[model samples]
Target: MPALLRIGRTLRRTLLQAIPTVLGIVILNFFLLQLAPGDAADVMAGEAGSATAESMAALRSRFGLDNPVLVQLGHYLNNLAHFSLGFSPRYGMPVADLIAQRLPGTLTLMAFALTIAILLGVILGSLMASFAGRIPDRLLSIFSLLFYSIPSFWIGLMLIVFFSVKLGWLPSGGAGTIGSRLTGLPAILDKARYMVLPATSLALFYVAIYARLTRASMLEVKNQDFVRTAYAKGLTPFGVTARHILRNALIPITTMAGMHIGGMLGGAVVVETVYSWPGLGRLAFEAVMGRDFTVLLGILLLSSLLVIIANAAVDIIHAWLDPRIGAR
Candidate 1:
């Protein structure tokens, strides 16, 4: 009961602290975009071709772009308080609806990418840790360094060239085949086929990071007194390493994994652009090009919320994994 109470208090405090962080992100995302020249009204007016001054003025007025920045901010906040994400002037649809439409694709991509990263990272990291000072460790270290150093966009393009263009094993771009009527299992397979290149591209950098982190963490824990004691107590070497050393090493891995959620989403912008996957990142790119402030801000706000939630969940997991964290 006391532990539960402590964890509850920690959660409450985390949430309280997050309020100011989220508010600051909202302000920054809104104002920074506003500071940039041009807006949805300008884009709309220009796209219309030879529009009159009065028509441009009316467009600005219609989208409330004529309002002062602070006034617009207030309106946005007020709408947010009412659970509203403002409409996108470019799309003629609510920003929330647009996000909802695109979110599933992004979620699916993230899920596959993250799962692959974790599995491969842990396995490779364990191998490196177990064979420290050996040929395999040296080889993996070089591999991880290369993976970490390369840009995701470059990796994505290279993957497309090799897997899609040369070998022709996968689709080069897009979430699915264009103008296809495939359905059910066939549709699922088609999407998965298209996903392979992008997911691998997105997952590679994180895999490298996690592999290095896991290797470092496991090595750090491997020599700890508890692990030595466990070994001394007649525990098998494998048992001491796997059941004890790996478990403790995972704390830092968990932390890195949770914190990387935002970064992964940001990276998706590049990966999705390269792959032409229609996810939130692609939507964000479109919004920026179109100066769709509502959709852009909506995406930023949603990303911030996801990051905060992920961090909060990490804190809770930390507490569960090591009760001392809850007490702190």
Candidate 2:
């Protein structure tokens, strides 16, 4: 029943769930990539008569394409064990390095957007729940519904026009200017300046979702016996609500937020493409167009890893916050 021991078991269970997910991603991507319409080797080699015949054979042998499907998959898995996702034969670079370089942009944007969304969602949701069925709550219900209905790509374009073009307050697309590196503060400012509009656009949809979730959670927790008891014990309305109601409602929000982290990355694909941010989303989109198999596989594997980790985090947070589940 000890908290530490309970946490250990919870973590073990979470990790165990990851094994099949990882294997599934590897297998699915492998088969699907094979099913696609062209020979990866030929695609990388370019036109049949364009490159020297001898050199094409060498490239194929170098990447292990000389082997059969099963042999190739085994080689792929072996390389993956050493953390070599694959080398992009087409791009002539390591896939892992490529993904690592672009990961920061996606992480920075997503982290900022999630922070803004959670802070705004919890606050607005709390207010909505507090004034449930009243005029303010009704207005919020309408607002969230309307905001949620807008497409992400459309919103990104609107933000670009209104803020970047019309007002000229933010950059139209690029993450930073050419010489941002020459000045540290300017680079940081430029980085954030470009991120603001895109991050805001991404945050809006999430806030709409989280607000509704928080509002429902707060309403449920508000009716619990602990809240009633605190109210009966001469506690002020705010005090009773803050200590008992907020703490209980937090468990649901924590779980929801953790689960949604992967969804944010998926959404980033559309958002990053819209703004032309140099991130995994844009990279994967480009890879598919170019028929860059190694890059596509790397992206799929990284995405699977991220989603699995997010799910594990949700379970761990759930156990930590509510010891009742940890006990079992």
In terms of TM-score, the best-performing candidate is 1
Which residue pairs overlap in candidate 2's backbone? none
Model 2 regions lying over 4 Å from their true place: 1-5, 41-62, 182-186
Q: Each candidate's lDDT (Cα)? A: 0.91, 0.85
Error of 1 at 215 (Å): 0.9
List per-candidate RMSD values in Å.
1.8, 2.4
Error of 2 at 253 (Å): 2.2
lDDT of 2: 0.85
Report the C-alpha lDDT of model 2 over 225-305, residue by residue, as the tens digit: 888899989999889878888778888898888878888888998999888888888888878876778789888898888
Top-lDDT structure, candidate number: 1
Q: Give one digit per residue, the lDDT tens place, for model 1 in 1-328.
A: 8767877987899899998998899989998998888988888888988888898899889989899999999999999989999988899998899999999999899989999999999999999999998999999999999999999999998998898889999889988888999999999999999999999999999999999999999999998899988988999988988889988988999899998999889999999999888999989988989999899999999999999988988887788778778765
Error of 2 at 13 (Å): 2.7
